[model samples]
Target chain A: MIVTVTPNPSVDEIYWVDRLKIGKETQEEYLTRATDSDISAGGKGINISIFLARMGLENIAMGFVGGYTGHVVVRALRDEGVTTNFVWMGSGETRINLTVLEHGREHIPILIDGPGIAVAEGEMNRFMRRYRRMLKVADWVVLAGSLPPQVNLAFYYELAKLAKQAGVKVAISAGASCLTHCLPAAPNIVKPDTREHLSFEWMKLGTKEEIISAGKRIVQDGVEIMIVSHEVTGDIVITRDSIWEINARVQTTQFRNLVGADDALLGGVIYQIYNGAGIEQALRFGLAAGIVSAESREKVCRDMGKIEREMANVTLNRI
Target chain B: MKVGEIMTRDVTSVEKDIPVKELIFILDSAKMSNMPVVDEEGKLIAFISEKDIIKAALPGYFEMLHSTSFIPDMNQFAKKLGQIADDPVERHMHSDVICVEVDDDDLQAADLIIRKNLKSLPVIDAERRLVGVVKRIDLLHHLL
Candidate 1:
């Protein structure tokens, strides 16, 4: 079973409008809210966890939560039938992330990074112990997305190391510091988008070839797979033996928004892996789902039948 | 029965001289299984399938592979890109064609497409210069 751990989580609030104005109050004429709205559950790993649950994978989401906002996140996960175990801090409210869309363009204009949860050393130790125990049982562990400040970059690396020791496959999606540091540790997969790639000084040249070469360099550092994502160019996967390019399937389906495609793709990969598909198949299934998510925006994952059919249409012949 | 009602006027067709990569991108963007290849004079020359692009761009065309993590090796993926590319539309295009005039009955066009399980049929003027192509899906939608 796949297990995802997010150090930070927030409620994702998406607002759709005809046009968005700066420094002006906007009225909601027609607003649609998701079934669950926990602002504190808005991290990459959390997104993937919810998607895995939707895909019918038996998985657990472990993280830290606090206050009323944290409670909302936990409640939503439970309602969604996602087995969640979040370490509760005695202080602070979880943050809320607001996504505003206008004229088919969506922007995360405001993200309230929730108040920091104060955890005593003992409490942190307890959470880590439990997290380590979970790692023991995890077939695949996804250390997802950004962390709230005060969380150490090495924290996820520790988890990855422990997961490796337990013979569990690990996937990490994080910022440059974390991704850069974790490369030597050799997580199975590392997802770094264009912005994250910008921090790599070696990529100053900024050609597609340079960017992919940098990714290949990261793979040489021991990462089994390097998922380098760019907005216009789509996402590319670099492995020791192969370099595959999957263009986002934007034109095929009518687009609603483009927020959760990455998380949805991660979930697809986890789901296919749980179903015993090979790495190649798992990646394809993940990309197919991701493409659908891009089209379905607001909708978390694509309809499974549509995903499968799209996957079928995507023929991946090696060169 | 109206052929105009069922024919697609804003259809996307590739020039015979277009690169295979551009053709693949168009087919992908259009979400179409096949596209009508046309010459500079906008005359139908060939039809290219997704399968054909995949085979041309990818080596080892016979091996059974899964959908995910499938990356075609770019170095080995030599596609004769433009004019001199080995897989030109003229060399590979199906020139033997079933076609219809714009004045033909829509039902007749639909019947021919359904019977043949064709994706599209070239529409011609009295002089047979390309005008529009009737698509199977468009015909089926009219029936609905």
Candidate 2:
């Protein structure tokens, strides 16, 4: 079983509008055509769950959720048949990420910082107990995305350690502090997107050699697989033994949505790894999911068959 | 004719490890006597009902009392169950639930519900992951 942890998930409100041009009406209102609006659950871990399920893999999404919107997010995942184990907060509500995408235009995303998490000492203890229990059932455990303000980023480090101790493979998709702390814990897989890698002071990933060196540094820290994806240059998968560059077969579609494609990439890799595929094949599958996700309006992947067909274009070269 | 065509897609369910106390709100608000307990894949691991909650909660009293007596207000009994709110429903839920596949005939689902005296039946896939639910009322609304 693949178990995922999302600390700060959200309910997203996506509005499809004609244009982004502001009118004199407060300059703050982005009017939606009522029928052009959709709401879905967001967060890296939840996206992983959706992508895995679409690929016919079983996954569980767990983390902290609260308030009315939390219920909505939970129900949405359940409706998608992704099992959830979110711990409810007593007071604060989950955040809502409002996105405005005009036809044939770039999306403007305004993210509201959701409820401030002040997990009581007792609550932390209880949540940890439950988290450990979940790790036991996992063949692979995924720690993904940003954490709530009140949470210590070291929590991921502890979780990775626990999963390793339990003999479960660990994959991490977080950035900055969480990644920094967990790197020494040496998860089996570390998938960090462009922005996340750019956050590092030493990571000047402009050249191909620089990016490969950066990935090697991470692998040397004990991570078995380090995957860094760039929208323009494609994906690089680095391991202790070898480095593989996988090409993305991105097709031009009038309708496009770019968000969460990287998460889908990680999802594909995990799905392949769960099925015991080799590193080269896994990277190709990962790129296939990313390419298909760009063609979908929803952040999650929609077409598994299309992804499979596109896999042929995902050429891999051992560098 | 298939269960997928008529089964309610928005089915309410609970996780196996959830506290039985949590069911009070879901069961009471939804007016549901029972709900399926699902695992990570949305597979039907078990089913929990009001009777299961009460049975799991009243174990202490059952062992203490030997003689039969008149019952008090139902609310009082519920109040007593609240004391063991931390107890997991996994201890009480029916693990071996009779479920219908989504592609199964609606007649087969209705007949199973009747034969087994079930309130509703879980609609699953070939993998046994829950897909929907077919309540008795759904059958009534369709046939009658």
Candidate 3:
């Protein structure tokens, strides 16, 4: 079974509108009705758990949740057949994230930040106890998303160390200090979340060569697989034995929503690797799943046949 | 109310290739009379119920008609079950399953359940994926 941890979960609300008006100078009331809207559980690990469960994989989701929004997250995960083991906070509610998609301009979505959460000492201890127990039966553990407020930057590092000691493979998808601090544990797979930044550990990822060098640096530090986004349509995968570049033959115009595509890619790769696929084949399937998610109206595509059909459009070249 | 509003979203389903023994265990443990059979993409393709298992264990209609004096004993049922225990549930499941969609009226689901004598109806989406299940008990409880 797979175990996933999301430090801070959210209730993601997405609205689709024909057009959005901004910076109006006239003193008039304007109303923009949404064409459609949807709400679901949101967080990096939560998204991965949903994706894995859709594929009929047995996975348990662990995190901190509270209030009405927390119940929404648990219900959403339960509906998808994901076992949730969330620690309820004592004082605050889970945050809500909003995404606005405009017609004919879905390539660029408007994302709104949600409120941050502060984890108390008791809550942190409770989560750690549950996490350690889950690792005993988990074949793989994924630590993803940003750290909550008042949480240490090395939290992922501590979790990764515990997982490694239990002989569970670790896959981390995080950004900034949270990503860099876990390097000492030598996670099996690392996919640096590059949505907020285009560099890794002070190294720029502006070109293919630069990405390859940065990825190799991480692999040299004992990470089995290191994936870095090179562009919107391509990614670079580096390992101890070889380096490969994967590209999806998809147009920007075909994208309907790109919010959860990255999470799907990581989930897809882990799913394949857990099922005994080679690294090259796993990366190819991951890219196909990512492309399918990007082209769908849903945040993450749950159709396995659609992903299989799109695999022909993904190409992998050894660098 | 729409089917989506009142349906039980946490559905327990199995794939097409599960063994009959495992299927029976799941049904007994979950206390469910029937279970939907989905494909790899989670689309509802068939359904299997406790009635189907009993039918499989019983003698054929022609055989029973041939010998009206013959009564089905535990030995007969056990032998029949043993023959198919290792077989996949797909061999005996009903491929033409009756289902409702999420946006359908709850009255429509009630009509189907009462008319068809079903314990529950699988609720699907536009893509025919199994999203939830609407049970007859749930419909009656909603009335109160």
Candidate 4:
């Protein structure tokens, strides 16, 4: 079974409007009706858990939740058949992130930051105890997403270390210091979260060569697989023996929603790997799943036939 | 209204193998009087409640009847609690659980709760996976 840890889970509220206009200088009251709307449990690891569950995989999502928003997150996951093991914080509610998508400009989404969470020491201890117990039965443990405020920067490092000791494969998807501190644990898979920035530590990920070099450095540092995003439609996968570039043939205009596409890609790869697929095949399937998710209205596409068809559009080349 | 519309979606559940001590802690922390027990695949299998814990701690009906002047004491309750704290919840959970499907009419859940004197009814999907729960209060609120 796979176990996903989302330190700061959120209830994502997405609205698709015909047009969105921000009034900067003029002060006027304007109303815009949403053509479509949806709310779901979100956070990198939570999305991965939902994606895996959609494929009929046994996975558990662990995190901290509180108040009414937290209840929404749990309820949504339960409805999707994702088992959850969340620690209810003593104070404060779980954050809610809002995304506004304009009808014609679906590629450019307006993202809103959610409230930061402050996890108490007691809550951290409770989460650790539950996490340790879950590690015993987990074959793969994904420590993803950003750290909550007041949480130690080495939180993922500690979790990866524990999972390693339990003989479970660890996959880390994080950014900034959270990712930097956990590299020592040598997680099996490392996908640098590039939403906030395009750099991993000192290495700039502006060009293909830079991304490939950075990926190789990470792989040499003990990560079995390092997947670095080279562009919106491509990723560089570097292992000890091989380096491959995975490219999706689909155009940006074909994407209806790119909110959870990255998570879907990671989830697809993990699912394939868990089912005994080789890294190349897994990456191919993963890219296909990501393309399917991006082109559909759903955050993560679960249609196996569609993903299989999309696989024909994914091309992998040795770097 | 459909049961899915009125049911409480945020229902807390547990597996059958959960320790009684952990079960009690969940019950107390969640402020839930009862919890549905599901299998690994999320199939509803049994139900455990505060009443069941109390029944386990107290003397049985036969024992009470046999002794005319039997009195319950803290020591007896404590000893019984200790004995069962580490035991799996399946030993005390009621296997015959009354439930409603998510697509069923809300009145069906209300009827079951009222007729069975139950606090809530576990709502399941077509595949019998525990999805949500319909409580006595939820029905009453929907009535208004």
Model 1: lDDT of residue B33:
73
For model 3, what is the error of residue B23's alpha carbon versus the real structure, in angstroms, after optimal superposition? 36
lDDT of 2 at B123: 87
- Report interface Cα RMSD per prediction: 26.5, 6.4, 11.3, 5.8
Give the C-alpha miss distance for residue A84 in model 3, angstroms: 0.6
TM-score of chain B of 4: 0.91
lDDT string for model 4 (A1-319, tens) is 7999999999998899998877684479778899999888999999999999888896778898887888888878877877677877776889988899997787788888586479989678767776776776689999998888999899999999999998999999888557878889999998888787767677777788887888788888889998876777889999999999999887888888888889999999999999999998899989888889988888899898898899999999997
What is candidate 4's lDDT per residue for B58-101, written digit by digit as tens? Answer: 75562546664566556777888899999999999999999999
lDDT tens digits, residues B49-114, model 2?
Answer: 887777765645665776536345465566668776877878778988888999999999999999
Per-residue alpha-carbon lDDT of candidate 1 for residues B13-118, written as tens digits (9 for 90 to 100): 5556555555555455334577776554445566666666655555564356665257555545553334325444454455666778878898788788889878
Candidate 3 Cα errors over 4 Å, as ranges: A24-29, B1-144
Against the reference, the lDDT scores of all candidates come to 0.66, 0.76, 0.85, 0.85
Better of 1 and 2 by DockQ: 2
**Native interface contacts kept by each candidate, as a fraction:** 0.00, 0.00, 0.06, 0.00
Query: In model 2, where do residues sit more than 4 Å from their true spots?
Result: A22-35, A107-126, A193-197, A201-210, A249-255, B1-144
TM-score sort, best first = 4, 2, 3, 1
By descending DockQ, how would the candidates be arranged?
Answer: 2, 4, 3, 1
Clashing pairs in 1: A9-A40, A10-A39, A10-A40, A10-A41, A10-A42, A11-A38, A11-A39, A11-A40, A280-B68, A284-B68
Give one digit per residue, the lDDT tens place, for model 1 in A213-245: 887788888888777665431556778898877
